[model samples]
Every structure is written in C-alpha cells, then in structure tokens.
Target chain A: MKFDAQWIAFITILRKEVRRFTRIWVQTLLPPAITMALYFVIFGTLIGSRIGTMGGFSYMEFVVPGLIMMSVLTNSYSNVVSSFYGAKFQGSVDEVLVSPTPNYIILLGYVLGGVTRGLIVGTIVTLLSLFFTDLQVHNVAITVAIVVLTAMVFALAGFINAVYANSFDDISIVPTFILTPLTYLGGVFYSISLLPEFWQGVSQLNPVLYMVNVFRYGMLGVSDVDVGFAFAGVIVCIVALFSYSLYLLESGKRLRN
Target chain B: MAHALLINNLHKVYGNGFEALKGISLQVEAGDFFALLGPNGAGKSTAIGVICSLVKKTSGQVKIFGIDIDKDFSAAKCELGIVPQEFNFNQFEKVRDILLVQAGYYGLPRSLAEERADKYLKQLGLWDKRDTPARMLSGGMKRRLMIARALVHEPRLLILDEPTAGVDIELRRSMWSFLRDINAAGTTIILTTHYLEEAESLCRNIAIIDSGKIVKNTSVDSLLKTLNLETFVLDLREPLEVSPTIENFSLRLIDSQHLEVDVTKGQLLSDVFSRLLQEGVEVLSMRNKTNRLEELFVSLTGSGAGENDEI
Candidate 1:
C-alpha cells in the first residue's frame, strides 16, 4: 500500500518489541550482559592467564571479539524467536495476519527488532569488556559491517525457528542443542589453528567459527580463517536465510494457517 | 441492495481429515444486519476463518463486496473487519495504541488512524482508558477495545463473533445500541452469537446453520408468520374444577391459579373468554406468552424455549 502507512506499521511493531524486552530488562538485556562479563572474568582472566597467546594477540584481546559476537548471536536469535512465538501463543499474531500489511513488511519489522536487540546487547558487552582489557579496533568499518551482518543472519534464523515452533520447548531446543554446540566450537576461547589439520578443516564448516574469526580479524587484523572467506560466508548466510524467510511469509505456510 | 458478502459452497477439511465446514453458502445484503445462528461446532467460526483466509478452504469461493478473496485478498480484506471471539490484541499496548497499530496494518495514515481511533474509543466508552494497557482493562472493556480496533479503518462490512459472550446485561444492552447506531450509519454488521434473542432483536434477515448446513434462511417477519401457534397465559381469580367449556380449547393448567393455552390463528380469543365466563371461571389477567418470533425460532431450530433459556 502506502509507504508512510507501512512505515507506521513497522515502527509500531518495533516499538512494541523494544518495550517488551526493556520492560523485562532483567530477563532480556541484563542476563546476557552479565553472562558475557562472567566469560571475560572466568575465561579471559582465570584461564587466559595460564595459556598466554592465542593467534599472536594477548589472550584477553583475542577473546573480546568472539565473546561480543557470541552475545550478539544469542541475544538476536532469542529475542525474535521468543517474541514471535509468544505472539503466536497468545493469538495476538492474528492482528497482523488479518491486516492489509504485506507479509514481507511484517517479516522485516520483526527481523529489525531482533537485530536491534542484538546490537544493543553487543554494545553493552563490548563496553563491559573494555573495563577488563584495553580495546582497540584495527578497522572500525569492517568490525561494524561484520557485527551487523551477523546479527541480521541470526535474526532471520530466529524468525524461521519461530515459524516452525509449536510450543515453548520447541523454541529452546535449537538454542540449546544446535546453537550452543556451534558457538562453543566456533573458536570463542581458542583459535582453530590449535586443532589438528583435519579438525581445523572440520571447524571451517562451522558458520559461527567464520563469524567469530572475521570479527576477530576486524579487531586484531589476525584470524585463523581467511577474512574474505569469512565475509563471503556471512553474505551467503544472510542471502539464503533472507530469501527463505521471505518465501515462508509469502507462502503463508505455518504462520498464517 | 448490493450484496456485501457472498459465499458459494465454501468447504473446509482439516489436515487430520476432519471436516469443519460442509458446502456452506449465504449472501449478506448491503446495510443488512445479518445474524448467523448455530450451536457450537456448527462451523460458524470456520466459515469466518475461511473467508478471512485465516484457514484454508478446501473448495468453493468467497467474494467480499464483489471481489474474490482468493484472487484479490488484499482488496477484499481492505473492505472487511472481523472482531474475533478471543481477545487477540497485545496486552502490553495501550488501548489507543492498539487501535492505531491495527489501522496502520490497513495502510492508513497516522493522522487519519489517530482520529478514527479517538472517535471509536470514545463512542465505545473506552476513551477514558485510552492510555491504559490492555491487560489493565476489564474483560468487557477489552472486548469493547477490540470493537474499536476493528472499526478503526471504517470498513464496509464488520463481522462480530460473540462480542457479548461474557458481558453483563447492562454492557450488552449498551453494546447493542452502539452497534445499531453504527448500522444505521450504513455499516453492514454480520453477527454470530449463541444468544438468539440478540439476533431476533437486531437482525431483519437471519440464517440458521445447523451441522454445517443452512437449515433456514429468510426474513425475520416471514419466519415469525410461519409459526401459527400463539401461547396465552391466563391468571384465574378463583380456583375452578374442570369444566366441559374449557375442553373446547386446548388448555393446560399450569397451576391451581394459572392456565396456559395455545390458540391457533383462525380461533377467536373472544370465544375462549365467553366460554370461561360460562364455566364460572373468573379471569383476572391474560397476556400473550411472547412475540411470535420466539416460538418460530424454537420450532424451526428445535431448541426448547424457556424463560431462562433466552440465549
């Protein structure tokens, strides 16, 4: 329909989403920040001191980008999956389904909300990390671009998860089983170079590893994986997830009926 | 009158192979307050769901204001508003904001949506709670808020599914008056309620759907005329034994002091009165049980009529 009208709907849904998380800041925003702080304390301070260098940079500096990306990924994915699923469970989603707003606009509005939360949490964790270690960015543009792209990719994944989720348990299943394993093996604490060549090749297949290393490269100018390959991986994931999410919305597969 | 809604042989079967609707068809005229009456599991909601595209229809077609919902859903939905049976608004949002967001979904400009939101909220007695979150409002207020949200875009046809389900008597009356006022202003209202009296009072044309089939569809006046039985309740001043004069009329003694009788259209009431006098039975007061429409609804739908069974 009209541009202004679609913009209004976008802003309304975004505002509602932002308010929902902020209203329960303890659960939505604070826990992730605190969890990241614990990782910095336990992993960076306690463990990193025992094992000094990780891929040429100091242990604290090497893990900062990975930890920040980790927070961004988890928060963005959880924000959208939980919010959209909650709307579905409460039947409030019918408000959008019955309206004249285009399906793509609805999907984008929710994806943006998720991305916003991810960026917000990522910023907070980055600031928290600064207190423990002196932070420096070799390329601010690449760092910003990689973090935003990573958030977008994960947000789209969350929307797909929400669409397929029939119960609250369904929402948590992926985060615990799939996401946790991927992030753990994504070189958050150690470089993939330390593993054997075969394991390194296997780790190359983990998408989160590419994200973490690329973000590390942006901050430290060093990565266990090629920066170009990392950026390419992020772009491919974004395109694929974006197209798939759009297709799901257009088909009205599980969301509509 | 132009038809506002036309359904032709709509069908719906669930993925599990359970059929909810079976070839249902009906037409609602422009500006006509049409009531679809049926029991639970009778597919009234399923029919609404299919027309709104919230549920997949197995076959048939639905046209809203001459636009096919299947081919031109956006255009069709733009002209229709549905107030669902459940409270589906965001409870975290303010009453006014809920309506504004719904209007935005319909692609209405901010200024226009806000103005319409204010108008409807005030008319529905929800303006005082405009800034309150929907969770804070009572059930009746929330229901009214939904009505306000549905009317924000000012569609040509409005479908209300049991809008007064759990509301009190006073609120129900006020809601009915508000709906009637809106209908008078040219909005076609399609209501589905278990309360048959509400339908009988508000709708001129009615459709009785039973077991997912249209059992009766006709003007209210015509349906009432078909019921030839008129019930008369007489209060007797003195208790009287059985008399042969009373045998001429079909009568049942409800109690020692009250007698109920059914009088056909061709029978004269004066004859009953004269016969009662001849039998030495004093008649204190007499009144018709109710309007003929009540009897017609009971007989046609086969729902027994009792004073407490108004719904």
Candidate 2:
C-alpha cells in the first residue's frame, strides 16, 4: 500500500462521517446530552441524596464516572451502528468500496468517527456530572485509557453488528436486548458489592461491569473488582474485538458481493 | 504499456446458482470509445461489477493499465471511474459535498478537489445546483452529478452503464456532447446503454453480450455492415390514396403522406427514389425506420433492446 494514499482515504472517510453526524447535530448530538442530564437529575440528585454515599464517596460523585462511561459506551456503539447501516442501506458504501480506499482504512475511519462521538458525549456528560457533585480524578491515565478502550470495543462491536444487520431493526436489537441490560447491571447506579454474593459474581461476568468499575476506580480510587484484572480484561476484549473486526473487513463479510 | 482495460476468463456465479457471467475475456485499447450492449440479464452489469470490484469474480485476471486489480487494486482503481446505472450517492449530502468526498476517496487534496468539482459541474451545467441537496435534483441532474463525482479523480478510463437511462432527450444530447469532449480529450470511455442509437452515434467499437457470453465484438462500422437490409421511412409530397408497389421492393403506405420501404444489400436507395418518382410520389424526406444497430443488436442477442427483458 502507498502509505500516503491510505492516510488520505482514512481521513476522508473520517471527515465525512464526522460531517454527517455533526451536520445533523440535533439528531446525533443533542439527545444524549438531554438523556444524560436527566440521568444526573433523577438518579444522581434525587435518589442519590437519600442514599448519601457508596464506595467511600458521595452517592452523586460515586455514580458520575459510570454515567460518563455509559454515555461513551452507548454513543460509540449507536453512532457506528446507525451510520454504517445507513451507508449500507443507502448503497453509499459503494462509493468507498469502488475507490482506492483500503478496507482497513475504511474500518479505522468509521471506528474513529464512532470514537469521536463517544468522546464528545463523554465529555459533555462529565461536565454535566460536575454540576451535581464535585469530582476528582484519582488517576488520569486509567481514566483516559479505560474510557478510550471501552469506546473502541463498543465501536468495534457496533461495526460487527452493522455488518451482520440486513435491516434497520437488526441494528437496534443487540443494543436493546444486550447492551442496555448489561450496562444497567454493570453497576452504573450502584456498586455490585450491594448485591448478594451470587448476583455479584453474575455481575462480574458482565463486560460493562469491568469498564464501569475501571472508570470508577480511576475517579474514586475505589473498586469492587481488582484494578489489574479489569485492565487486563479490557485490553484483551479490545484486542479480540479489533482483530475480529479487521478479519470481517478483510473477508468482505456482508460488505462486498 | 497495456490496453486501457483487459479482462481474461472472468467468471461469476451468484449464491443462488445463477451464473451471471461465464469466462468472458475482452480488451479495450487506450483512448478507444467502446460500447458494451446486452439485453437484460445478459451479463453486462455483472462484467462491470467484476471490474469495479463491486462483485467478486469467481475466477479471472483483470488489469487496468497493466496493473492487475488483485496485485495493485488501489493503483488500478485510482486510474478508473465508474458511473453506475443507479443513483448511489448519499441523498442528504449537498451536491458539491458529494463530489468533494468522492475526491477525498481518491486522495486528492481539498484545493484540487474543489477546483475539479467546479470545473466538471460547470461543464455538465450543474454548477448552479452545487449547494442543493442531491435528492432535490431532477433525475437528469442526478445522473450528471454522478458523472461529476466519478471524474473528480481525473481517471484515465471512464465506464458508464446506462448513463442516460431515464434522462430526457435534451439533457441526454448535452450529456453526449460532454462525454464526446472528454473522450476527445483522451479519456477512454466504455459505455453500456439500452439506447442503441446512443451507442451507434458515439462508440467507435462495440461488444454485444448475451447469456453471459460475448456474442459480437467489432468496430461499429463493421458491425453495422453485417446489417444486410435496412428499412427507410419516406415522407411524400402528395397524399397517396393507396399503397404503391415497386418491383422487388417491400413498400407499405404508413399514411396518406408517408411510405415505408426496405432496401436490401447491393440495392441503391437512389433507385428506390427514382422508382417512387416514376410512381408520381415525390420524396420529401427519408430516414431509417429504426436504429440500424438496434436491429443488429436484436438479431445478435436473440432479444430486443430497450424492452421488457430484466436480466
């Protein structure tokens, strides 16, 4: 491959994807901000005041990292799924496929587009969290790393979902049946330690639990799961999902022919 | 240096056991205006799909300018452009944005892309619609937009599949002039059209495919030469109460002031005029009853062009 052409193609797709979502900012960017605000108002402010504290931090502050992670996760996943599926549905994907853009560049460009939305929403949700409670970053590196990795993993997951989806309904099924349930049980509103021993083990089986805890640990210096194990798990999942996504792209699964 | 396009033994079988193309090999020399015509389901689109990498070939070698598609696809693809029969652009995107994004796909810088976008849009009479959303454009303008988008990279070879399928005649004529200018400026063009007249008027060489095979491949003049008989429609100076008869001539009275006649090989059209004049029917104007190539295409493909065939 000519490296310059590859980079150019990647940037082109990335920029186009960004322009698409940004152009419809009302549809793409606003809803999440409103939803996150409602979550902060309802769960963190009203319910949190009565609960008082958990995990050695104020209840509002305790839920802040997870909420931010939730925004990042969902936004990352939805952005790629909708955008990619739209491309396929409208046959606009043919534009890139018939061009000199390499498959990997196409993949990276879309993934980065998802990542961009994820981080933007994450930042907005984080800023919203500040209004409800004073927050501190116990570890900046872990905070950035875990959030980035989690966004990437879900973005890859969304890419795979879009590839396999034959209809618009197929794209939303996984998020509805799997992602929502996993995130809610992943300790966003409460620590898994509050659950019974068996259910806590069950909660640990959820991948989102690992991400939310890692993010929480980065913010509050407190976690129910081992920080080292969470780091390892997130890295492994990222590597595995990234490899699989690349494989699907290289094989042109659901993309070509 | 090699031919502008070379496909050797290309084959494609759909998942449902229908073979769309079967071991078709063809070449278009550099700077040639070539036409690929076929009835519906005759494998023209399939062959194009294989070359554009939109469809996976079961087996074949495809080279663009001597660069094998498999070995150097980016380089090969960068050297070509495709205007598909369908509109495949992002509907929500502005027309100029569509062209710019297509340019970016080919690694052209923004400044050059904008320059080319303006140039092609102006040439195609689409500069005024640059800011409008694509879906708002008329069907003819949308086709023009696809052409502008394809040419942003300044590709050496351009392939058009039924480019004027739904375009109005006035727009089609202007588009033909635009295409002629580009072809004259040295961009090799490969066209597939249902309009046999379009092919007959523009293409230098032609290939007709049927049932996944190339039925005829030759120069346009040579292909037309195979046409042994051509029918002509004549407008008369006087109204005829009845159809006229000329020796060894197949003539029919279309109306009071019109007549249709067949002129076979080795027969002079002047003789038909003289014979008609002797019959007291003065000829005002004469024209082919139908496109000459359309007739030949129907003969070769075993089916008519621009009809109900949907392969």
Candidate 3:
C-alpha cells in the first residue's frame, strides 16, 4: 500500500475502535469513572483522613496521582484486550485481514485507540480527583510524557494479550490474575520507604512501581525511585512491547489459519 | 484476454495433517462467470481461504489480475474482493458503516468511501436499512449487506463462496441478477454454490473439486454434454397398474400416476411420449428428475450435492 493509503487505513481502524468503545459508553467509559470515584470516596477521603501525611503532602493529595496512573494503565490495557478479542471472537477482524491494510498500520491503529481511551479516562479521573483534593502539577512535561508513555506500554501489552486470546475467558485472565495484583502492589497506595529494606528491593522489580512513582514525581515532586531510571525503564518497556506486537502481527500468529 | 485469477500448483496442508488443496491449478478469464463446485470436505473453501490470505498455503503460486500474490500480496489484494462463506461483519454496526469502513480499508478517502457506500448500499436494496444494525437484518438481507461491503472497494475480481446458500428462492434470484449485473460490468466473478441449478444458470465455466483435487474443469455446456444419461419424472393423466414397456428406455413406476424414466444417449423425449401414448398412457406433465449439472456432479464426486456442506 502507498503511504497515503496506509494512513487512511490506519485512521479507519482507529475510528472503528474508538467508535466501538464510545458507542458503548456505559460499559467502557462509565464503569472506570464510577469505580475511581468510589476509590476516591472510600480510600482517599475516608481512610486518608487518619493518615497524617505522605511524601510531604496530604494523604489524599499523594494518592490522587497514583490513582490516576492506575486508571490510565488499566484502561489502556483493557481497551485493546477486549476490543481486539471481541473482534477476533466475532470474526470481524477478517475485515482487515482480507484488505490491503498493512499489519503495522493495524497494530498502530489499535494501540492508538487504546491510548485515546486511556487518556480520556485518566482525564476524567483527574477531574474527579479535584473535587476531593488539590492536584498541583510539579512538572508539566514529565507528567504528560509519563502518562502517555505508560498508556502506550500497557496498550501494546494488551495487543499481545488479544492476539493470543482464543476465548472470552482468555482475555480476562491477564487482568484478573496479573494486572490487578500488579497495580495494587505497585506503590499505588503507599511509598516503598515504609516497607522493610528487603521488601523495598523486591518492589523495585515490579514495573508498575516505576510508572506509579514517576507519575507521582511528575505530579507531587516526590518519588520512591529515581525519576531518570523510571523514564528509561518505561521507554524500554514501550520498545519491547511494540516490537513484540509488531512481530505477532507479521507472523499472523493465532490471527490467521 | 488476461485471466482474472491464476493458480498454479497451489497446495494447503492444514495444521491437523489434512491436505485441503493438493497441488490444484485453475484459471478464470476476466469478465467470466465461474462456478467452483465441490462436495463436503472437498477443499473448495480452503482454496479460497488461501487466495484471500485467511489460510496459509503450504506451497504454490496464486495471482490476481496477473499480480503475483507472493511478490506483492497487498497489491494483488487490492485487485480482489471476497465475500466469505460466513457472515463476518460486525453485528452491532449500521449497514452503511460496514460498507464505509470496508472501503476505507482499501485506502479510499472518507468522501469517496461515503459515496461508494451509498452507491453499493442503494444498489443492493439496502439503502432503507443503512441505519439499522446488521444483527437486526434478516438472513437474506445480511447476505446482501456482505455483497455490498465487498463491492464498496470496486475490486476487479470478486469471489463469492456460496453467496446464496440458505437464502429464499426469491432472494437468491435477486442476488443472481445483481451478480450478473456486476459481471456484465466487467468484474470477473467466481462463485461456489450447493445449488447446482444456480451454477448452471449463472456460470459459463464450471469446476468440480473432490478429495483435494479437481476432477473436472470445463465449460458448463461441455460438462452438460458429457452427461449422457438423463432422468425425467412424468405425471400421467390416468393411473397405470403396470409399467410401460419401451425399448431403449429404462422405465419404473414411481406410483399409479407417476413414472420415472431414464433416457440415455440418442434417446428422445418425443419418442418416449409417442411410445407411452401408443401404450394408452397420457402424460400430464414432465420434469427432469435432477439437474443435469447435479447428475454430472454426483457422477464426478461420488457424493450427492445436497444441503449442509460445511467445508
């Protein structure tokens, strides 16, 4: 395909994905917003009141950035996993498979669609957080870069998950058994400094810790890990995930007979 | 004239150690209406799957409009359109959106995509249901929507796998007319249908594949000519207690008023009628016991061309 045509095809797939989620807002968009609202009400407002301070800020203030990062990563991941898996289950992915659209265009389109949803939901959670606590931006550049990069990383991971998924249950296994546990344990609720030295070292092994801390650094000027290391680690994750997703598409693994 | 599709030594061995297409080779000239007939598990769908890149080929070469598939698959894909045997569109999408999105996948701009979507949707009698979600449409309507979606890109070659399967007769005839119109407008068509009469009525060339091989590849008229034996069922005006004796004709009494007669080469229907009349039997009406192409298909494949061929 020519460059111009490839661009059009990319846009087409992206639009189809965006429409797929937006058309079912109650299922895709509303649930995350409502769930985040509950978290803020119960965890940040109710529980954080007893906690004096965290990382030199009010407990609610410290937790807001972590919550927003959590939403971004999870929404980005789930959007691609469910949308692509649904397309596969319905055999609707054949529409693109039979077309002249290149595999890279297909990959880029779905990843961007995931990123779009993730950012939109992240913004919604951020706006919701403002009602409970004041959110002061420590660094605008770092804040934008980390969230976008984090969403892209998770979206790519979701794309790979969708490719290997053969059934509806397969799509949910990663999020339930893996993603949920990682997000909760990845410094979303507390600073690693509170942990014993050995546990703090173990927390460093969790990728989500770097993401959450870097995003917290961007938002609150405080982080449990080095900001530079987090940025480098997230970039490496993006490259590795993106390459693997592209490789899967090129190989037609599980997508073609 | 250039061939619209060319397959040479194409082979496909599925993951389960089953060979679907065993080095089969065929060609369809541009603008010709072609029929690909096969029995259950006869590798017709597998061949189409390989051509459309849905199933990987174990070996061989395929070209669409003279563009080699292996050399430039995307370019070759641009020259072809496929309406698969199943309904593969998104059920929740509106009729028009499906067409528009398909057009876009071929790299058409939004304006052109919309124009073609409108054109094909209106042409296929789907304009009224353009805003309706696909799942709400009837079976026939959904089939028409798939045809519209395939044509939205205006491909030079169109391959339809059982386009009218399970469709009502009225709807089937309409789809045949539409397919004929597109072929008339210079689009090469390759169709597969369980309805033998459908192939006889629409296709100029016919191919019968069985057991992963092409048993017969010839023009429809030529294949029909090879059918030396023809059976006709006759309805008699009066009940007959005994079968009629006719030389050079095999006759059996299906019932008191119905007779099954087999006429071979050099036998005439007029002669049968005259001999039966002399025997004091008056025929009310008569029809062929089975389609001529169907008989030939049965003879070639050693299987009845009946319904429920999943492969």
Highest DockQ: give the candidate number: 3
CAPRI-style docking class of model 3 based on DockQ:
high
Worst 10 residues of 2 chain A by lDDT: A1-10
Query: Candidate 2 clashing pairs?
Result: B40-B311, B41-B311
Candidate 2 chain B: 10-residue stretch with minimal lDDT = B302-311
- Provide a comma-separated list of chain B TM-scores, one per candidate: 0.89, 0.94, 0.95
Local accuracy of candidate 2 as per-residue lDDT tens digits, A1-257: 47876787788888988998899889888898999899889888898889988987888898888889999999999999999999899888899999988787888999999999999989988887788888899999999999998999999999999999999999999999999999999998898889999999899899999899999999988888898998899889888888898898777778887
CA lDDT for candidate 2: 0.90
Candidate 2 CAPRI assessment class: medium
Each candidate's root-mean-square deviation in Å? 3.8, 2.7, 2.8
Q: Residue B270 of model 3: what lDDT? A: 97
State the C-alpha lDDT per candidate: 0.87, 0.90, 0.92
Ranking by DockQ: 3, 2, 1
**DockQ, every prediction:** 0.63, 0.79, 0.89
Report fnat in order of the candidates. 0.59, 0.80, 0.88
